[model samples]
Target: MGHAPVMTWTVRRAGPGDVGELARINCESWQHSARGVVPDVLLDRMLPESYLNGWRRWVRLPDPDGVFVAEDEAGRLGSYCTVAEARDDDDIHADLRTGELIGVHADPLHMGTGAGRAVHDAALDHLAEQGFRYAVLWVLKDDWTTRSFYAHHGWRHDGATKDHAAGDQRVPVVRYGRFLNARKRNRPPSGFRFPAFG
Candidate 1:
């Protein structure tokens, strides 16, 4: 019923029923990422419930699109990802190459076991299928793991950074973008390399 183990997995279009697992993973990812700024007590109290309500609310939002959980051969959830349409001045950027990776998390219990890759592959496939050519996600400047992850996954920097409002504080985040329509070798010339540990 929950995330466990499997060889290959399935990724479906997420719906209302997915709120619970989605919430769980979201909270787990956030709680892990928001180490000091978010107090332990506050995270413990707010994360799970916030995830539940937030997923529910987002699922009901207009034109709100996202993929479902990646279920293993054992019929359990492994990982989850969501792609949101991005609004930008560049039509190419906004249309084929400009979606936002909103949430991507694997069950901590199942972390580093290919579940994350499965979810990522499924989400990218979904984006390509939907005619998206560019995609982006925000990552904390201080979080090397996630930054390294996106870099390893073929995402490149657009040379853009932002100070976004998170809770009661400002967080420095980097923007990682992928050009779906470009040649596979046409990546940003940052000369950055991140080893995919998975």
Candidate 2:
């Protein structure tokens, strides 16, 4: 049998009109990726309709450019990611300027079509452009596939962990972080002294 044709996708800022498609992609991704990991009862509730309101808030923001969607040439939305200021007070880099990659999901059907990575890259770029010096995201601890994906993209565990509320149950999750725009620090003159030492 012949191999499946390669697919290309374009990444763009999501708008109010794209909320429906984004919801569908989100549900489909959760259903497909969380099959064995999440309880079937809980996964069954991951319906597209259940995500509409939440997606609407993201896409309808005054500046929705922080939310990105990837569309295939066939005009189908296959993936999306939302990025914004870090929300959790316990974020690893609490004292530093940081951004959060709220979520990133790709339709199972578009797994190998670059849809996921396209939106992923777009989110990071947007965060950097918004002047975030660091970025963070949470992922299920047992989700090796996703952990690998983020690691491959320069994210590190940062040794932070938390429990995510999935329906009535809680799953252990870990935080990943990366520097969005790191620069070398300039050293003081040859013999600069600290105020305490001086």
Candidate 3:
């Protein structure tokens, strides 16, 4: 029996042309990850079209931040992440040169394929390159899997919490942060290249 060929991923900066795919991935990932935590009504109402419009606007605007994506050898978008200057009023480290990891989602089917890691690593590297001294991200309080994932990647909860309204319920989220250069501040690994953005 012949073994299947392993798939590799390419990481790049997301552009306007990728809005549709990015929105699709975002919507689907939310559906998969928020099934029980988020209210059913809210999840059901989340259409790709709505997200597409938001992504379109973001891509059209001038953002000092960056959106990065990971694609498989077959040219399918497997995951995406976004990083930007911390703009949250609740951020405790607002005084520091901090960046916020706004979002990072992987296709449910691609969860274990390193797509998430590829985009996450690139996002951190990009933030460091942008001269951010620290980084922060929010995750569902009860989402153990994702929490552990971020923890393993060197993030730690800083005892911060926020409530996100979903229907009649206010879902709690925890904040995680780390030094942007906590890990090595070198170039990305071999075979992966950061995209050039204006």
Best-fitting candidate, measured by lDDT? Answer: 3
What would the per-residue lDDT of candidate 3 be over residues 1-198, giving only the tens digit for each residue? 443333588999888889989988998898888888888788888788888878877666445588899998788999999888887756636344678898789888787778888999998898888888677899989878788878878887878789977667899999887776555543333554331111
lDDT of 2 by residue, 1-198 (tens): 443355788899998889888888888888888777778899888788888898888777654148898988787888889898887766636444678888789888777667778888888888777777677799988888888878877787877788899999998999887777641221222453211110
- Give RMSD (Å) of candidate 2 vs. truth: 5.9
RMSD in Å for model 1: 6.5
C-alpha lDDT (0 to 100) for residue 145 of candidate 2:
80
Q: Please give the lDDT score at residue 17 for candidate 3.
A: 89
Tell me how far the alpha carbon of residue 156 in candidate 1 is from the true structure, in angstroms, after superposition. 1.1
Candidate 2 positional error at 184, Å: 15
Task: For model 1, give the 10-residue run with minimal summed lDDT.
Answer: 189-198
> 2 or 3: which has the higher lDDT?
3
**Residue 53, model 3, lDDT:** 76
Deviation of model 2 at 190, angstroms: 17
Model 1: how far is 60 from its true place, Å?
Answer: 5.1
User: In model 3, which regions exceed 4 Å deviation?
Assistant: 1-6, 61-63, 92-95, 184-198
Error of 3 at 28 (Å): 0.7
